[model samples]
Target: MLRLKSLGIVSLICLVAACENSGANYQPVIDGPVGPNYDIDLAQCQSLAARQGAFDSTTGASAGTGALAAGGTTAVLNNKGTNVRDAAIVGAVAGIAAGAVQQQQNKAAIVRNCMRSRGYNVVG
Candidate 1:
């Protein structure tokens, strides 16, 4: 009975080894543009940034004009005019910079969608 049990154990080990050595045939689906999709997303983000910048500039110009009209020369030389305009310009520049950074992130999402549509596995 001991000999029989030993033989059974050896057989089980052999079977497991064989299963481990079995080959699997797998084909991955290739999808989407082979390159980074940053260009398209960057363009979109730039457009958005430009729009925001224009809006900020217009608002700043209007505020500066109002300040000038209100306080005359003092407002023109002091915080009322230049300060508000500078703040608006800075805000516009900061917004554009943020938009550009966001574009990179958005590009990854766009690339993922494109790849999914073509049936490729997106590495998380």
Candidate 2:
């Protein structure tokens, strides 16, 4: 009951964060003149980045860890912590949200690195 509510709140937060990140347009900063293949290279790199999905096995593991930690902490703090399940749900949601943000960052890095490997002076 309470756990479900907490999970709902956490889910909402993660949803909002994901939406914000997705709406952002990422552009690599070039240090010099653009080559003729610049567009092609960029398109390829972006395609690669797009293929990088947000959730992975690590994300699932993190959620489990969060659940365990939250449940344990809640139990310890309140003895009969009726809210243990709720806390666990919230922790798992937080972990999932963190994972999502991390993946977004990873995608950006991939694009930058791909450009750099192609001999573009990506300053950003």
Candidate 3:
């Protein structure tokens, strides 16, 4: 339905905007010519990102649980825009959106920290 789609679009935009704000002003140092040192440093930063992201397992699980719980609650509400199919779609969207935001935030933090530590001014 148009209403459902619009709700989803709004929710998605709000969610993405919120996440984008987490690193909105950040400008990473990816300038200069590519070379071996850049590649090695980038790889190290990626490794650090992986480690930093690992801390999000619990957060991810909690987000999943919350989305599912909210979805179920919406269905039980049985009010407008709370039908079963719509509830499921909302739940899936919420879970995926939240997970994606968390990952992006983590990666941004990792890269910012890494670059900053390497004497690059990462402003956020």
Per-prediction TM-score to the true structure, in the order listed? 0.35, 0.80, 0.48
- Identify the superior model by lDDT, candidate 2 or candidate 3: 2
Tens digits of per-residue lDDT for model 3 on 1-124? 7687678968877776565534423346654554557656656776666554322565556556756776678767875554655666666667667765776677777777887677655555
| lDDT of prediction 2 | 0.76
lDDT of each: 0.42, 0.76, 0.63
lDDT of candidate 2 over 55-124, digit per residue (tens)? 5458888888888998889988976666887788878877777667766777788888999999999999
What are the clashing pairs of model 1?
none
The number of the candidate with the highest lDDT is 2
Q: Give the TM-score of candidate 3.
A: 0.48
Q: Extract clashing residue pairs from model 3.
A: none
Task: Mark the 10 consecutive residues where model 1 has the least summed lDDT.
Answer: 19-28
Ranking by TM-score: 2, 3, 1
RMSD versus native structure for model 3: 7.3
Q: What is the lDDT of candidate 3?
A: 0.63
